[model samples]
Target: MNLPHDDKTCGWYAALPPPQPARRLSGSQRADYAVIGAGFAGLAAARRLAEHEPDARIVLVDAQRVGEGASGRNSGFVIDLPHKFALENPDAQFKQRLLRLNRTAIAQLQSLVDEHGIACQWSHAGKYQGAVGERGLAYLAHFEKLMAALGEPFHAVEGRELAKVLGTTHYSRAVFTSGCYLMQPAALVRGLARSLPENVELLENSAIQRVERDGLGGYVLHGADGQIHTPRLLLGTSIFTREFGYLHNRLLPVMTFASWTAPLNAAQCKRYSGTFDWGLTPADHAGTTVRMTQDRRIIIRNTYKHVPKYGRSVDDSTRESIRAEHRKAFLARFPDLADVPFTHTWGGVYAISRNFTNFFGQLEDGVFASACDNGVGAAWGTISGTLLADRAVGATSSLLDDIHAVTGMPSLNPPEPFLGIGVRTRIRLAAWNSRAEV
Candidate 1:
């Protein structure tokens, strides 16, 4: 299917060689576990399940190849900090455990790279998110204070201190820490796909159509060409889980558009004093993240605004718009590099739950769902998969139960009729506000 170009220079994830397709099952099969979606969540879950039950049968199926979905299209930055703090939702006690789980998952990913010898470039350099204006600065200041009050230790920098690390005065205040790392994300996903043990079966290009009750207290997962019957079913579709009826209403799949610039020469690099390895995001209402790859190409991404009106797919217009915005953003932060041309651009869908937190637990008997990474999927997806595996294996883990018990969905304006139109209009106004600052 030749979808319109989401952006141009194949996304950062596409720089690596395409992964070998997975083997598809043709007939009805029975397994102890059936994981639907072979991204980090499914693959990690499958691996964890195998570790806990060496003799159990496990199968993983993806509509496309492994890492082909949002997992493969990410900016390649593995984050560790809680994207949303406990103070952000003061009433939610589980945020503490969730934050710790994110930290633990990132540590595990680093360990996986070492133990498996995955060749993806791994760097411990941290990520930076800052503010440029009064409103943005106020949010940063309060957030910094909240972090301190909550005992979340981090390097908070402002003015000259921030400029020393980033080589740009574009930010007024910033938060920095060694809590995250940048990786060749697609390569890591491919590496994991390659290393999945012999006992687990992976299916690529195998679209699951429906999961129905099996009548005998089990579930039957039907694909276009095959079926899998198991006592337990886990859906790891991430942002794409909207296609399934159960999650469609509660999950919002946003389009994140990204682009990569041509390789920067030493002179171009020196414009920022070669300190361009870090990832950046402005604390504005219309948040945009800036990152550079190992190849010295900068990557930029922002979320989808038009939902019901445009649906979830990306078109050439949206792709070009994001590219234009990125170039302008880069130049605003580093004016000397405004003339540089971007070499590649692309976009992908990411799932968001109504409540802003990714979810866990059984949506139905024997059918479990995990999605909505709140625009940060890498580390959280791994953590969720591992937690799910531990739960499936009957391991006594309070963390898993804690996450499932914390409920109350995030409410967004419905994407229907006038509501969808209003949502898009609000986004346009926000973008206008952002451009006005420029």
Candidate 2:
């Protein structure tokens, strides 16, 4: 199947100044190591390879510019907590492992941000999982039990208390936890790409069209404008791993939508927001993840779609419908700020498995793959990419074992038509159940 590619961007990218011009490949090239996809995983992979082999020629390529794809399109939460979906069981040891890897990922990203002095609004205010009704609150309370069992630190807060952190008294209850960070998603990824070591060459507008083993023991990557042959190739293409026929039916390509409100005036801020900026995810899985940004805009993300394929942007009708849903969410939370228009709305793709697993291993000769973030890309991507590079360099760590144990190869998905119907129906039922939270 052909992997989809869309430039559908959110307001995060638009809020920033124009980015640096992209560098594209124009001719055939050869490298000692090549990492495909310059998102968090690809960026970390290239950096780690350079760290281990500073003199080695490492090439990093992406179809769009850095921060233009899903990496840049996320809500900017670098969370180390077990994501809501991670509550598969009461396995305390498993929870510890999940949190440990996430912590390592955060530490690695913080090191880069400090070393390179990247200004991406990197905040340590953490995040909250809040609910707006009894049902939603029950979800938060259930998650609280798991957190307590893991010895996690958190404080429960009601609507008025929660409003101080988020600036609106919309949520009925919440749990404030440590170990999460929020930032401008696009800005942070761009900064990471820009700070890459000098030994690594970053190429944009260079989507990998196909890959085949060259007769001379190298993999040939055919880009639109050029080709690259490398002794070692690391695939960090995420959902597009299907494009290379690696994770075919194992990975599902799905879409999610988000919109950003226009900047609020001082009076509006005084009336609507608190002194501090904060981010929060819904207590309900199908609900919304919202952020009261540092720059005074309210960003809300909700709703999911099953788009098994990519390459084309979503239609305007879809965008408008999501925008309407976003509007509804906005009004529910901040009816007083209903005038705050969603300046930009967009969608991004996520690769999911039946049991929320990721893929990390050798796909073919000289081909190492690390992808399927299971909806937690920022921290997961960083750690997976770093560890993948280690695997490629023959460097072993206990973390690798944990990765293999938890994120085993994805289970097979149901066949299409039925698959589509099943997924769509599940999402619809879940979303309907979470409608109050949304």
Report every candidate's CA lDDT.
0.72, 0.86
Q: Could you tell me the TM-score of candidate 2? A: 0.97
Tell me how far the alpha carbon of residue 277 in candidate 2 is from the true structure, in angstroms, after superposition. Answer: 1.6
Runs off by more than 4 Å, candidate 2? 1-4, 311-313
Name the lDDT value of residue 136 in candidate 2: 90
Q: Compared with the true structure, what per-residue lDDT tens digits does model 1 show for residues 152-259?
A: 677778877778667678777778766789887778887887888777888888888777789899888888788999999887876556566666556664666676
- lDDT per residue (tens digit) for residues 1-438 in model 2: 364476555687877788878889879999999999999999999999999999999999998888878998888899998776676556777777888899999998888889989888898988888888888988988888878787888989885566776777888888889799888889999999988999999999877889988998888999878999999999899989888888888888788889988889877877785555688898888899988888888889998988876536468887889899999888888888876788898888988988787899888778998878889999999999999999999988889887776677888998989898998899999898888889
* Top candidate, metric lDDT: 2
* Full-model lDDT, candidate 1: 0.72
Report the lDDT of model 2 for residue 348: 87
What TM-score would each prediction reach against the true structure?
0.89, 0.97
C-alpha RMSD for every candidate = 3.1, 1.4
